[model samples]
Target: MTVYRIPAAYLHQIEQELDSDEKETMLFLCQDLVPDLPVPDVRKLLLALNAREMLTPVSLSELLYRMKRFDLLKKVLGIGRAAVEANLATCPQMVSKYRVLMTEINEDLDKDDLTSLVFLLMNDLGMSHVKMAKDKSFLSVITDLEKLDLVSPNRLDLLESCFLNIHRKDLAKKIQKYNWEAPVHPIGSSLKYVNTLQASFPKLSLADPPGIVNKGRLKNGACNFQTEQLRMAIPETGGALGQVSNKYRMQSQPLGVCLIIDCIGNDAGMVARTFKALRFEVRCHLFLNVDSMMRELYEVARLRQHKNYDCFVCVLVSRGDHQGIFCTDHIIPGFSLERLKSFFIGDRCPDLLGKPKLFFIQNYIEASNHQETPSLVEADGGLCTIPQVADILWSQSKVDASTLDRSPNSSSYYLTTLSELLMDPHKRTLPLLDILVELNHKVYEWNRTNPAEPHSLLLEHTLRKKLFLSGT
Candidate 1:
């Protein structure tokens, strides 16, 4: 009879004392441990043990010692000594197959393949199975495994959407990698910086234009010495201020910006130039009247989240005699200042204070006339008169507190009529320069036709003087 010799290490361990049952169990486990061994070799070992009929406790212990010496006991019977007993209690063959499968899968999976497999298992697998699978719980686990060395520009939108849905705040922190900070606006440029900021930071939210209560009144209130300087300045000032507010919002880096321009004949080219200089990217929502502008602002504010802006700039130009009422008790009754404060203060670094929030009012407010007269003396410079037309007009208005209480028809009827005329489509179609000219012509005709209000004559004189001096 030919005898096959096991390795010396196995032989040394097998020489020790072992029980018969232990020897049979150890031999079974050892066969399972040798994953890719020839079936013939396994059968030979089993047959040799059977032929001997030495499967006693001492023999089993000896075989177990041999398996242990070869460091195969753990692989064959799982981790602990009791694990082998547990395996035997269940379907032992099934447990053996599970061990083999785990080993093969571990060796076969690369990082990318593992990530894809995990994603497949998580997204495709049933809820019950996912709950049971320990490794498939976290979706980010796969992302961690597959992240590239260089930053992937193509993944920005994907990352933004994912982070937004996932509520991942850390995404904002990663903005530095893309250099997404606010840039400085160019000086002395006529471009609207607010619009530039809007274009650059698409994520920010901006206030809408101020609301206009009496669009007709705002348009044709009074061009004579009878309009409030503040009322006249309010529309243009509000626009400038609104731009500042938008700039602040964009600096905070929100999700989107909104712009509202409510003026009959706005200098769109000037506005475009100003915005370009400021590097603001803005999308404009234009409104011809105050009611529509205010309605939209209120709607946006009411529907949008608390920190979002609702009212931005309201551009109300008065070519005739009316003032635009941006915020009113009726439209947004009981609208809280606290809410407005939050709009500006919601961000960690608030950008709304102590800046150039107002601009270009002197052009509109100052009397347009300033010319050098003949010098009284050879050394003396020419004398010039600079009448503050805005102040004089505001002071001379006949609408007192009592008049304000009456209907719009009762208060300054001529101003009201002019407001109505400017609101007409035919009137609005004229260019701003042509409109000013036409307005002067109309005032001259009115002075000729009507004699009750001598203020019209004064207004005509002032306008003509300004036009002559400015050479417009």
Candidate 2:
């Protein structure tokens, strides 16, 4: 007898209706069982569920119910809300209670709440992870924790402590509730308990139980290894859909200033022209040394010109090591990426406050043996105000240094592709997020064809709305 799975049309219909936040919420709830998913599309998520043999009609209904997507539940599953609740009451839930609790806590967290949480976890998560999480959702932070083996069903102590530190007593209570109702077993007993669960509910597919030897393998040959590193490489948007209201305001005449710092003096003209076509006033600074570059950035950040604009874009094309980008003097380590963005934060550039600050960094990395020694910048302890990194979109790409030896007229793959995409009349009307998704796909395709000199692009943002550069 063939087991029943959700129909492809039903998955397509459900995927169509989910907004960005709803898709992220579903991914959060499924993170434990289906951790480190590359993209947040509803269809791929459901397929993962099915692969684990957990995508039963009842489990799907429960997931939709948890998401409060009753319309999909009723329309696609032909299951009523009450019926789902009743079924959940009688049967075991495929998604773990811990994930559900985490999802609820995430839903309750606002921007300030997430900021406080990141600050609290700074020491534990380190500067790199903190920087990545600063502009992302709470679920992204939790996903990292899951990757590091820091959070689990039995590992609520650290999370609960963070919640309390953030002054979220109500969210803390949810964690406490999970701890109370969920069974606590010694690490050694996880396998036995998993076996017992399988025996009790054969269809129940739990994520790797804490302390299970295999870590992330299913009993039925399912490969659920959560590759967190590759998550950003793939496009998150998946594809376009009907227009939605959740986008950034980009209606200003001169959208904003496009400040291009081209160290090699080769790509600034092209990049400058691209943003200019999008209604931005372009400022190109070519071949600046460290001191001059810093001063120019400082002046740009304080310029009165920002007051007339709706957005700000900074393009940096240079050589770089792991710690920071190199200037004309490549022998010494130059400015850290964080330091570059610091000048335009709310405190320093109040005019650009609440406006989107977009940074596009394309750095060519020298061979490892010739790379500069990486050093910590903020090694000295000092009292300084930490900027809230909201309304900023950061896109960085690292390419092989050999690419720089190419024809001077030809720019780097990332900047060239970005300029082409922005200048494309067809894509100008699409939201920046959608264009980025396509860019990521194009880069992946390039990597597949030329494995020797591959490129990587990372998109991280705290923009609260969609960004359309249609020049309307």
Candidate 3:
């Protein structure tokens, strides 16, 4: 018995509308699918349906030729849907084997939150003191774990076990209790910020909140859209399309970076040129005597307008302290880091919901970085900011007048080194952490050798994937 999955009524409706040549082509293409219908007639039906935009262009040929293009087929079959959907590297047992080199994670290296995590795993947990800590095979596993694109819950449990074994009950408790999926707490916050804002709104889900589809204008095109579209866009590291699906090949994510420099005594052109050389279409806004709030609004508006970009880089070069940055106009009110992040969230800028957002700020004073809730977040039915929200990254320039190794570069050392690292042909393919690790090394060496007024860059990022900017 020959069988075809396509409906008989659908075939009949389309077959009546095709031209002779197109009908012939459709029949030839559907030769294997339907033994009941002749190749020629099948071609007629295909062309007929195509005229009404029922099928995609070259879609049938792609399905036929690239039957094995679905790389996830085997994985899906081997495990249940949950296992296949769990975006993780090896398992807990596998991660447990890598605890030997845990002590080597130097806490002194000024870098991102990921590096700090390694420090917590290595030095604080004392994985190096375990039975097989010095084994060569154990060290090999550590090397592999470092390259993983994400830290899954399974891996977190393994690290937690290491903490328990070392009698660090407090550290173990914190690890077990922390919610990785929750909204990230503002930097230097004493308490965590939960998604209470969702209860008030009750409408904004993890999916597109609003403003994405442009109301009545978002037509579902060749893509499967709401059906297969969501799964297809899952962020897969080491792939050209980070979270974007293959169906939308014509659409490309743009390279964007916003540099807000308060150039009272700083050079803006030098930084702009560096970012441009790195293929970043940079937007430089100089706030010489303008109110700081206006500049913040400008950024919020721009972020909303260009939410389709794969990555967002916001660099603030301004004076002031650890708490907030001051504009050149000497305004009493300044911008807080958390407040800036709120403007780009899903509730406000729904288009950029799951994308990566990077922030680099150079401060001029020492002040408190306490978590200050923005009015928008606390408003009636406002959205709560969650952790791991679209891969938030933050890097701050720290200058110590106390340390003898502190020496300030005439220009921004952090930006210069980071720009050069991003464009380095040899190392450009590496993940964001790998690049930051390189930057840390460069700055570490620079301060060691110079030592006039020592400078160190504070790196902290909560991005959940391996970010690679290739030729961008």
Best by TM-score: 2
Q: What is the lDDT for 395 in model 1?
A: 13
Model with the higher TM-score, candidate 1 or 3: 3
Give the Cα-based TM-score of candidate 2 against the true structure: 0.45
Q: Which candidate wins on lDDT?
A: 2
Task: Name model 2 segments beyond 4 Å from true.
Answer: 1-245, 369-388, 406-409
Estimate the lDDT of model 1. Answer: 0.29
TM-score of predicted model 1?
Answer: 0.18
* Per-candidate alpha-carbon RMSD to the true structure: 30.7, 20.6, 25.4
lDDT of each prediction vs. the true structure? Answer: 0.29, 0.70, 0.44
Candidate 1 residues lying further than 4 Å off, grouped into runs, are 1-260, 299-315, 318-472
TM-scores for every predicted model: 0.18, 0.45, 0.41
lDDT of 1 by residue, 187-210 (tens): 111111110011111121112123
lDDT (Cα, 0-100) at 471 in candidate 1: 10
| Of 2 and 3, the candidate ranking higher by lDDT | 2
* Per-residue accuracy of model 3 over 1-472 as CA lDDT, tens digit each: 3322344444454445445533443343333233244334564545443443333312332322222223322322222334322422221111111121232221211234334344444643356532233332322234334334112212343444444444444554554334232333222222211110011111223355332321111133211223222122333322455454322111233455555554433546666765566556677767644233443443454454454455666777666545455666544344444555655654344455556667766655533453332111111121223333445766666553133123333556656777778767777777777887777778777777766544546666656566666632
All candidates in order of lDDT, best leading: 2, 3, 1
Compose the digit string of candidate 2's lDDT tens values, residues 1-472: 4655667777778788999988988877766456546876677887776765667677778888989899888888889999988977875466667678777787789999899989988877889999999899988898888677666665655676677556676786776567547644333222111210121111111223322232233343234433222111111121233334465557677888989999987788889888888889899998877656765776687688787788899999888765578878785455567667756865457678767889888888766665432121121112122223567777777776777776555678878898999999999888898898788878777777777767766676767677888944
The TM-score of predicted model 3 comes to 0.41
